[model samples]
Target: MAKMKLRVGVIGVGAIADEKHLPNWQELEAEGRVELIGVCDIVSERAHEMAAKYGARVVHTDYKKMLADDKYDIIDVCTQNRHHAPITIASLKAGAHVIVEKPMAMNSAECRAMIQAAETNKRKLMVAQFMRFEPDSEKLKEVIDAGRLGTIYSANATYLRRRGIPGWGKFHIAKESLGGPLIDIGVHVLDLAIWLMGCPKPIAASGKVYRMFGDREDLCNAEWGEPYDRKEFDVEDYASAYVRFERDITLTMEVSWAANIENERSGVSILGDKAGISTSPLGLYGYENRSLTTTRFDWLPPQSGHRMEIRHFTECVERNRPVRVKPEESLRVQQIIDAIYESSRTNAEVPIKAT
Candidate 1:
């Protein structure tokens, strides 16, 4: 018997779709594992361009029209943060498994709605927390799970850019992106660190967000994209937070798109009673025979996390297996994100009641 080919449809034809999702799906199609059925974007030209490149049979300016066809077996939602929930719920209700882009949605409420839709339709819904699928993350998880990082008590996640404010799309708008670097890039390291620590239930968060440098287009050290109107920048350029989790564990995180720093850097460090680990150099520190020791893995898997993430979702849908990045876990992450933003607003700690 031959394997069934998943008919895939992509809802967003933006940078993420073009860079991560489409390339992987195109490769899977070339391998005769799936079919690129259609591509949709509010911009018809972008949709048509992606469709032509990826061998998609149809192009749609509206996602609802594409969902009405009932030809897709898997729908990949790669739209902006605002559109994640609606498109995901619609896709799941349309009888297709879904893989949505990161930060889940604009808020925890939307994340819950997406989860409910997936449950009601009895379909798999996975978020694109691609960091979890990264080779280094996988190795770290293995070490932690093996009890090497005994009694994990705390973690510090930091992603800082000296002047890397994104100038594309609606990133500078709070309505579209919910928050800035915290939700945009901070979520990646935050999710990985929390996942490595076994997904502890978050209790509360206290944080501060700053909008200092994003509005200054005169800054000469941005990472990418052209200049945009400084007046349109309404989101935070930097965010710092401390989150308390169950089991007396804690996580401190810092992320920024624009900062008055010397250089850009990103990584996480987890501290345990018995052992500690840092991600950038993949180093392990512990006491061996009552002496301080350090270890490093010279052999790490050289795999593209985006490709692995897409392949994992496709295989789970094909085999009716559970997805790696569960909807509930993503909801927790969203809750933390929401609480952080709220904490920033009220200048007080916001409680996160476990679901």
Candidate 2:
């Protein structure tokens, strides 16, 4: 006897789908492990185009209609931030495992709802936090889990781009994206750092946000390749936050889409009692015999983050195993994000309640 090929459907055939999700599904299809059954987008043309290119047999403008097909074993929700919760919840109720894009949802409340829906339907819900699948990130997780960086106490995660405001999508709109680079890009490093730290429970957050350069046409660069309305850009261009966890562990994060900095830079540094680890040049720093030293691996296995994420989700669904990026972990990430936004608005520290 042979196993039936897993049937997969993707909603939101936009940049992320075109660039990452669809391509990876095509690879899985080529390997005879899964079938791309349908592609859906509000834009009919985009959906049909992706279906034609990616071997999906059906195209739909509405995701609900696609879900009614009941042929799909997995649904990939690549929709906007606001739609993550509804689409995921609905997909789970429709009896399909879900893999939604990062940040989980606009707020923690929505994350809780999505989690409940998954539980009610007995379907797996996974957040597509691709950074966790990257080569350097995997190596760092291996080291940290091995107790190499003993008793991790604090971490700093920063991702900054001098003039990298996204030109496409509704990233600058508060309703669409929830925030600027903090929610957009900051979520990546923040989730990575938290996951690497064994997901300590976040107790509180203090943060601030600034709208320094997003709305300035003169400051925004065309390198992102889209003409966005300067007047419509109303989200923060920079954000900084400090979070405390249950075990007295702490994490600090800073991220920007447009900052008047020396250069674009991004990195994460985790400090433990014995040693510390950093990414993007990926090194370990510690004291050896009362002398400071650094350790750098000569090579790490090259893996596509997006591909690994898609493959992992599909395998989890097929094998009845747990997903790497669990929904509860994503909820924790969302809780921190919610606290940061609340702290920024109140001009005071906001306490996070772990549910």
Candidate 3:
């Protein structure tokens, strides 16, 4: 029997759709993997534009109406973080599987709601934590599994940019979108830590957010600051967190947009008793008897992210299997995020309660 093609509908034809998801799906369609069914955006012009460009037959401003009228098997939510839960729950209840853009939802409560909706509908719900599909990260996980990183102790990560802040549709620094680099770029790095630690349950967490990157709406100047305003800075441009995993593994996360750091190092390095490894540079640093040594070797591309993640989703939808980036797994990440937010608010450590 021949494989079935998933009829895919994309919500939000903005930067993420145009630059990543749609392109990958286009390639997949060219390879006979899936069919482009519909594209919807709150902005009808954007929907029409992507529809015309991607050969989608239907375009609509209201995603609910699109779901009602189209025969799409999968609904991909690429909207802002706050929109993730609503769209995903709607999609699942509409009898379609969903692929939500990362950060899952605005908070852990929303994440749990989405997870429950998926379960109730028996639909596949996935958080687009694309880093888990990266090859280098996959290899590093393997190294940890093989005990190369014996008795994993600590994990530290940094995701910093000189001044690159998002400027599209409340994505830059909207408090509703959860603000700052932490939920934006930092979510990926934090997810990397959680994934590398085998998605350990976080016990407690503490965090702080900074607003030094100016405002979040129009006024701030940079490549992506046209839609930003220095006066409306409601979210943190910098965020740091310390998470305690179940096995006593503590992960430290730092992310920033307008920091004093030189260059970007968006990676997580795990310090184990035997060795420490990191990606984005793929370095292994450890003790050799009396002397400490750091080794960097040329390895095969470890970060095949966007395309692979899209393909995996398509595969799961076609096979009727649950999504690889399980919704429950993402709930845990949201727990940490909620803890960070609560910690920042109360100026104290917050206990992480898993959903």
Estimated TM-score for each candidate: 0.98, 0.98, 0.93
Q: What is the per-residue lDDT of model 2 for residues 134-192, given as tens digits with 9 covering 90 to 100? A: 99999999999999888899999999998788888788899998999999999999999
Top lDDT hit: 1
**What is the Cα-based TM-score of model 3?**
0.93
Off by over 4 Å in 1: none
Off by over 4 Å in 2: none
lDDT of 1 by residue, 45-101 (tens): 999899998889999999999999657899999989999999999999999999999
What does each candidate score in C-alpha RMSD?
1.1, 1.1, 2.2
* Clash count of each predicted structure: 0, 0, 7
Error of 3 at 185 (Å): 1.2
Q: Which scores higher on TM-score, 1 or 3?
A: 1
Over the full model, what C-alpha lDDT does candidate 2 score relative to the true structure? 0.90
Error of 3 at 179 (Å): 1.8
Instruction: Give the range of the ten consecutive residues with the poorest summed lDDT in model 3.
Output: 216-225
Provide the overall lDDT of each model, using Cα atoms, as 2-decimal numbers.
0.91, 0.90, 0.82
Clashing pairs in 1: none
